[model samples]
Target: MDLSGKVAIITGSGRGLGLAYGKELARNGAAVVINDIDRASADGAVAEIVAAGGRAVAVVTPVGTSEAAGELVATAVETFGRLDVLVTNAGILRDKVVWKMTDEDFDAVIDVHLRGTFTCVREAVLRFREQGGGGRIICIGSPAGQRGNFGQTNYSAAKAGIVGMVRTWAMELQRAGITVNAVCPVAATAMTETIPFLAPHIESMKRGEPLPAIIRRDVGMGTPEDAAGVIAFLASDAAADITGQALSIGGDRLALWSHPQLTATDFHDGGWSAEDIAACWGQTFAGSIESVGEEFPEEVMPK
Candidate 1:
């Protein structure tokens, strides 16, 4: 799918998954506006894209604020003449169990991931409407948010909120022909190097060796590039009808995630009292109870 005349803004794209997204989208013919807090990295990314025969520009800035959001969109429009896609890939991680997580930890994650996504999408949507057509909004999400994680209270909350907004905005923007979706990506980057399951393999990655087949196929962990294809496709015309969906992508693994839905429902003649519900809870709801947290197969243990 070619994005020959499209322009895209990918936030936090200096490196890692965001960088992968920018490069992939550009490779597909989209002129990319790269956003990142680090000026050096942002400029380097833009240069790399240009060297590879792709059109790109850098607007180095920390996301999560309305000003930054406006600047990002403005750069896309002023430089490329129009904005066709936005990927809210900026985020931070503060891993701590609930008891140990501080207010600072929580707020920091929320500001970057949750608020950053909100402001960026808001700006992109406004531009799309002004352009008199539709656009693509791809918000980054996490598996931790879909199923709770032990030490990711803040990260999970922010990601969960992002997906929630995607669902809501998809409905609200349907009339305007805009598509909103979430991508839950898993890859080995600086952000995930400390993860216990992937930690042992960092050395291999540093050596430029491919991720072990077992890790990619069984554990679903891979390089950032493995997950970039989906981001690029979502930004292309091919995926215009796909919206309000949460998709998981990684090395050797791609799956469509089911949104929260009722597995079972029962009706009462009137309203069931607390005691009346307690009496029937075991039979009515106990069978459909779902487990939480990410599940790694025993075979996935790092050797």
Candidate 2:
């Protein structure tokens, strides 16, 4: 997919996954706008892209703030004359269980992941609509959000919110030809390294230990490049009809996420009393939920 003449903005594009996306998109002919909170990182990425014969510019701005988000899109338009795609890849992690998670930790994560995504998309979607066409919005989600994790209550909740944003925006912006989607990329970045409790797993990774088998193949561990390909594809015209969807991009595997399947259906229409809700919760949380006579195989076990 040639993105020639298209103007694309990728948040957090200093290094890691964001940088990978910016590099690939620029190579594919898009006039890439690299956004990062750190000016040096953003400029460095732009330099690399330019050195490679690709067109790119760097803009350092906080994605979580409304003013900064607007400036990010404005920078693209001012530099490239129009906006075509937005990749919301900026985020932070505060790993803590719900009870132990402080309000600041929760807010920081939510502001960066959820609010930042909304800010960027909201600005880009308007430009797209004004240009008399739809545009693509690809958010960076996570498996932690889809399947609850031990100490990622904040991260998981923020990411889960991104999925909800995609679904809602897809419905609200489809009329204007806008397409909203998200990709849960599993790249080992600074965030992963900073999770203190993951040191053992990091050491294991260094030792080339493999993850459990039952998880989807494509959902296996991956590098930034693995996720970049999907981000680039979704931003291209080839994925025009695809919206309101979340995908898992890991390794050589790419799978459509069935995030909702993890949650069982509820039959009641009206609100249930507290006792009724307690009873339902008790039953739901009671025991194993695997298919009848089908035990969870070792292959599908968690890491």
Candidate 3:
């Protein structure tokens, strides 16, 4: 946790989870580079860090672009002298179902989440390699990437792509002493406040519209601080051996983020027919429904 003279660049550090991370890193002795599109918030964050006896500078730039990412990295090296840790925490949500989703929505989300991570990490990787040592690249991901949400197709795809990018980058950069990882964070912010619109719809429900009670239970739940601890760990020396892993931080839980595991997979290996695929789907659904136990009962949805 003693970052000391290490230079860290955090995207979207003006507010929410990114702000929390900047505060923590600065307090711990790292000279931080705070990046955000909003000049005011970015300046305010750096000022707070300075007021608290932490060295930091604010950079106003759009991280979704490669040029901006390079500029951000250059600012860190030029101002503080070296780049050591990078936390790509900038993102936006443009939620919509597949059919209702616009290309703009999909593009924007991917540009900010997936492409932004790529741009920033690629820029930092060069410095890490040139220095002939290890560095940390922490990308922000989401639970929607692990478990699909109804109206978050764009966000989910972008987040999932982030995990893929981290995994690939980890292997590609391992020899260069650079480690890449991801954190699937759940925070209470502007993004979560829109969840009422993202909640799943059940057409088969005889009750027609989804009840207000069910919707209320599922949205806007975790706090920004909940995500900071995990990001801090990934950005720390303690996590040096851990790379290409996706960890989830939400509420009171911290665990590895993973995809669904099937009882039997690889139907393609044996060349399954249509009937085999249909039967597999039927068994999987039945088993899954029963496995949920009381977690997903009919009364919750009300037939």
User: lDDT per residue, candidate 1, 1-303, as tens digits?
Assistant: 799999999999999999999999999999999999999999999999999999999998889899999999999999999999999999888899899999999999999999999999999999999997899999999998899888999998999999999999999999898999999999989888868878777668888888878788777778899999999889888898999999999889998899999986777888889888788889998899999998887776656
Question: Tens-digit lDDT track for model 3 on 3-63?
Answer: 7888899999999889988888887788999999999999999998999999999899887
The sequence of per-residue lDDT tens digits that candidate 2 reaches over residues 29-75 is: 99999988888998899999999999898888878888988898898
Backbone clashes in candidate 2 total 4
> What lDDT does model 3 reach?
0.79
lDDT of each: 0.92, 0.81, 0.79
Query: Model 1: which ten-residue window has the lowest total lDDT?
Result: 294-303
lDDT of 1 at 224: 94
Task: Estimate the lDDT of model 1.
Answer: 0.92
- TM-score of every prediction relative to native: 0.97, 0.83, 0.83
The RMSD of every model to the true structure, in order and in angstroms, is 1.3, 4.6, 6.8
User: Number of the top candidate by lDDT?
Assistant: 1
Would you list the clashing residue pairs of candidate 2?
213-299, 214-299, 214-300, 218-253
